[model samples]
Target: MNYSRRHLLQGSLAAGGSLAAFGDQHLAEELERKLRGRRPLGIVFCVSDGMSQGVLSMSEAFSQQVRSQGTVWWNLMSSQKAVMGLMDTASSSSLVTDSAAASSAWSGGQRIPNGKINVDEQGREIESLGETLEKSHLRLGLVSSATITHATPAAFAATVPNRGQEESIAEQYLNRVDVLLGGGSRFFDPKVRKDHQNLFEIFEKQNYQVIRTRNELLHSKSEKLLGTFSPGYLPYELDRKHDEELMKKIPSLAEMTEAALSRFLSSGDPFLMQMEGARIDHAAHQNDIGAILHEQLAFDDAVAKVLTLTAHREDILVILTSDHGNANPGLNGTGSSYRETNRSFSKVAEITRSTENFLSQCQQELRHSKLDLAEFFTSTYGFAPSANELDALMERLSGREVVEWSQQHKNSVGLLGQIVGNVTGVGWTGICHTADPTQLTSTGPGANQFAGLIRNDSVRDRLLRLLPI
Candidate 1:
């Protein structure tokens, strides 16, 4: 049955009115049964890329500290209405998985290599969920904080042997995806693209409203939209929050989520939309505690928006999960009997910028004039680094070898993270993807299919069952 706004509203009003008029218990029970039997008209899948168990816990704590409230995700897990599960995230080549294979497991229904998207180990092409949905005349939408052609989003709609082939992935989304909102404007701009192909013009010719600014996105009336806010991945939530001008130019993850989802909901189309908070993974890779927590919170805000928009509708299913774990950042016990734990964790709130922004400033300062590294660190992080820690950071930035046990932690960002972690009580297990199952939760119709420990490869089939073609 093709579910439309009229059909759904009429069914609901009729059932509700009849029950209210008759006031018979049997009539109410029959109405409930029929409502439960109806299939969903849409599905929204939210991804907090590279979020670990610790990230979720820290985000909850951070939200409580700043907003004086628990996070939406934490509340969802506490509630009885949502079904919770753990996703077994792995790849064909290794126990650890990158964004490409992890998402491919869900989109293509196969555990390919760590860096391939919808391509099997033998290089065979697998049909992606977006492609399959397109064939059924169902719409697909992708909203991400990463470049729109990044691994996680690309796995859903585009097939390529290597995840690095982003230009090709951008091309593939032309007709397959109905709503595309994120970063990576360079891939669409003819002047910046290597191929000099004007993707914006092409998409506009195909009836897509190409937008580049936050204002345009907010005012856009077109149902078919392609909005790119940055040349690459959008600025990290931590960085964007502190910059006044950048805040006006770029939309929040929640805003993008709303823009994509509202269009689908109003159109009354049976659709699949994927919303991603992509910066959490980048922050985790850098072992930046402040950035990671802020990114996770941004993702949580998007989750809250999703639940609110679908609250009254019984025809939308929402699933939230992470692709893989990275750096596994956790707050460690500090001081006698761990009494200092909260105070130590509180230091994260003082961080004014991401490590990436800090490093960029350091580079500019060092090149142009004398920069007191110690003073710079104190100003940005709200704490002065010790002489030895400052020396190590400077050496690492200069490409000098730092005697770090883990090869992944030998970089300048990792060194800075460790120095900051000393005060924040947070510790990271290197800077790379971990072999861990990710948290999963779902609500609305067919949510039970995600309960318990589910493998990533089973996601496509579960979604397909709910969305009959």
Candidate 2:
């Protein structure tokens, strides 16, 4: 049904609408044309934020260490069904696009500005692919390592003037989505919300299987699952790999993606699930090689999981792409030096883990009610400090640590010095997005339309045209 048909069906047509009322004839025509000969039961749009070319190459190489066969996504890229494109990730304001515009283009079929969701230049509202597909009577799923409100995932479901409108985005959960997972628990907490809308309670009341712990996530068999694994962004793969505690407590992206597919496939038809590896961008921003490589591997594992489940499904389409490029990650080769690093790195990945593994146990002691700051620090970061260090940390942390450190100049200097001491010179250009052409690869039926170096908007335009909701 078109806009007018929808309104007329509800017996309340809005003013200034030009669409004609829905007719059974038109409905039959749509079905015959799109759904008759073809059987695209579902689509999964997976986007990695700010993945540079070097990032992709290195990630594949990194995964090769795990299986020696290399990254599944890269191998799938060579298939005939796959289409290649250079996504011009420019937003309305710059050559480089932020997560909002880059993702909105894919989610809404319209190019928007940086930091805006489904809004146009004139501040008008636009329905995202998530909302559109929801209206089509299809189950909707959004999975990301970041909070669901983080720009890319929000681009398809929430319409807001600013990308930072996370609290309101959490309210959209009441739309009764089939499956939703990721971080950003602060937005759902009643005490954290200024408007007194405790979304966690709302979700619980809605009978959604709300899961906050890894064990809960592992055991959940509910029809609908809402998992917020962290208060903020989940730890990078580097952190998770290094930290044994985190690895066991928090499931990998692969597990989350596979769980979503299982829940979606149980619904008897194809569903829309978009999976994002959010922390890859954060790792790039921090210029942490260990973090970047591990996170990309996590994303690759998720991609591999999807392919394993959907590879034989003629009705399932998978579009994998990145929003923009960050830090232009590259391995400065000294001939075999790069190769040597990978060999050593693979061994290191097995032995070393993320810092978060050790920190999770510390969270209970660090909770607001307990408030043992010094002990918390001592246990988490391995810095059993004197009174002077404790005093400084108090001054820096203020009363509550709802917000994490920004990794800024002086802070970065001190923190890095304390944790992995005595570093200098290297710093993030800015805590912002960078402009660069991204990569897009698609597979499954009608995936040919996504080929041959297209624009970012073409990703959506093709999908909408090929499968207009």
Candidate 3:
């Protein structure tokens, strides 16, 4: 239970080392004793899809500044209640792993190529954790801020050659998954799917209560539930909080976690639930610092809710991790150091929308007549750049410079990220996924199994070892 960073790093260097080799026999015995009880054991995996160490640090700092308390994840580390480790997130094909392969590593315990979901290079489908657990009579659930059919969630529930086969993924959810919550109504709607199959109707006929709004999800009492709040991915946490319609329609990540937990608890059967803050990856991909901070914080809130639910229960195991690092963001040092960095980041609270959404709105508004770029930035982002900054942005908008810059950066989103970074001290390395090792924290039963450094696929190995076969 008491592990120093040096000890963890030393253990990490030994590729063949495992939880038993770590010499935590007492903890393992304790977990075994707890598992021997009559109540079935439950497992929950919480993933912030693209969070890095820098992202965790910044989000914890921002949470403390705004709420006078550190995030639940940081508090867990500070309290040493969670066993922490590093996970190398690489696919068989590349060092940098996409969400599909990253999650597949955890789901199938295999090193598949990037862009695959629980499917190996041989074109064979591997049994995902969800399918395996469901076969063991364990209730299964998948929740995400992104669509349920998105790569992260789909990697757990469905096995496909490509992550893009979302329609097939949605169909797979019908009998396999007990609880499914998130967006991607388009994949299920007859109007949007190329095959024109009404998956929702099929789900309804299967006795699943399909809910589309926040209120419906909250009131649903069905044993099998499907909630889709958006046609595509849900809005960013910052945008959802600022928009009245979104606040009403879309459930927060914590809300979805709570709902999923409610259903799983009601079943009285052992369960495996994977909850993902999928938009953390999207925001990081866009290099939107404010969006990333809020999304990570939202994920932390869900972690807190799970901790609350599992407070006194030793039968539950909680694993919190990220699939991979995106955009490698950090709070760059400034003249005033900590004070200036805090001051600059405090401005993120004023941001109500993502740069992508704001730009879309701007394009819609500009179709009528000429628009003042300076005023628009001021109103939308809560800070107006100087006249020169406005002129430069305007020139980029007018010429091919935007396209050229995007080739080097992350398109227009990268340009906006640079502007925001100038005001805030946050900086991004690039707009692509990094091969950096991500953090993993685990508590409750089998927590020691996840300690120290391991490959991403080993996470699945440890979880399977903890499950009662």
Candidate 4:
């Protein structure tokens, strides 16, 4: 249904009966709007799990270099239609928040300590947004590039004292969430679960069409669907893009977003859907510039999909934001007059694997000679490391300490990220979450509520105010 602003306001007024009880017309209208809500048909909450401000700009530049075009997020921000804001994120216990605490603040309307999902610092279980929406008969869906039961997605629906309880988080979603997509088949596979409870069979019995692999997801016509594409978190976009097998098996974040949204749009019901680009945080934690940029670009593609799908639908609001910032990555000037900066930054496009994958490969090929290791590094990173850099990396990989300025960069992944960054012009602060606020961009009906600075803990109330619950 096409709902005009005037029409909704008129309905609100009608629902309030006569406005005479209020002395002022402005007060009456405000009260009417508050009672009726913005009442969007659905809200698409898109999260780039740990995207800092620098990541957004880097992704835009990266897209221009590789895709021959700018990112959807860059275009959206430049357009007058988007409402911009910054989210003040934090946990009750610390200034720098973890994913579980940050996401819990958004879903539970309060800040808890780090490492807990929707559970307060005092060990009380707060009702998650999914549970509250379920009670109101509104459907909820979750999509991510991380484990389906990972912190970001789990916080929306599950209340657990410890965020590591993937099995418990998986069980909590059985009846509450209407649609589930993303990785973590191990949590659902009876063969892998410690208790050996077949979640797939249980979901099938509940009328959910359980599926795995990209082909099944695209072809299946089920309204209620459960799809898990990997045993753990999905592979990094850079790695997946280079692997034909992964391309055939794992669906992109945009594809999963489309599948989840299509189900809710077809139902024509009031719903809340969270689509996350989860691995951006993982890449950031490892200080992987190439992986983080590719991940952010993938997320921007998903944003484009959402905007295109909802272009003509006035009742669907799309909110794009992040939970927190991680290892703030930025491009630094290189050579005289910074002329070499672009040349250096352009080299990031040549990276073929995530630093995590690079480390994994190194572990498997530990016995290789230094010359063989140099060749492997050159093949994977598209640039050869200096002899001293290679020696330090080898030492770090072999569990020997290499003196580093930041204590955080002493690990293999951190050392490798810096070595690659020396060629790519990118630099990382450290290998952990930052206390900085994250970017927020919103569009569609009810987008104005998210304008200006938003507190993480206030997000739940703001979302509920716009939605009819």
Compose the digit string of candidate 4's lDDT tens values, residues 43-133. Answer: 9999999998899999998999998999998898999999999999999999999999999999999999999999997799999999999
lDDT of 4: 0.90
Model 1 alpha-carbon drift over 4 Å, by segment: 1-38
lDDT of 3 by residue, 344-399 (tens): 87887778788768777767666766667788898877898877666666665554
Report the lDDT tens digits of candidate 1 across residue range 1-469: 2343334333444323443534455654564455547567899999999999999999899999988999999999999889999999999999999999989999999899988999998999999999999989999999999999999999999999999998899999998999999999988889988999999999999999999999999999998999999999999999999998989999999999999999999998799999999999999999999899999999999999999999999888899999999999999999999999999999899999899999989888888777789888998999998889988988877779888887778888888889999999999999999999999999988677678898999898777766645
| Candidate scoring better on TM-score of 3 and 4 | 4
Residue pairs of candidate 4 with colliding backbone atoms: none
From the highest TM-score down, the ranking of the candidates is 4, 1, 3, 2
lDDT of 3: 0.83
- List lDDT for all candidates, in order: 0.90, 0.69, 0.83, 0.90
* Per-residue lDDT of candidate 2, residues 261-377 (tens digit): 877766766577889999888766655545666788889889989988986667788889888888665554322544555443343233233433433443444565566767665
TM value for model 3:
0.90
RMSD of 1: 6.6
Candidate 4's TM-score: 0.94
Error of 3 at 25 (Å): 17
TM-score of each: 0.92, 0.75, 0.90, 0.94
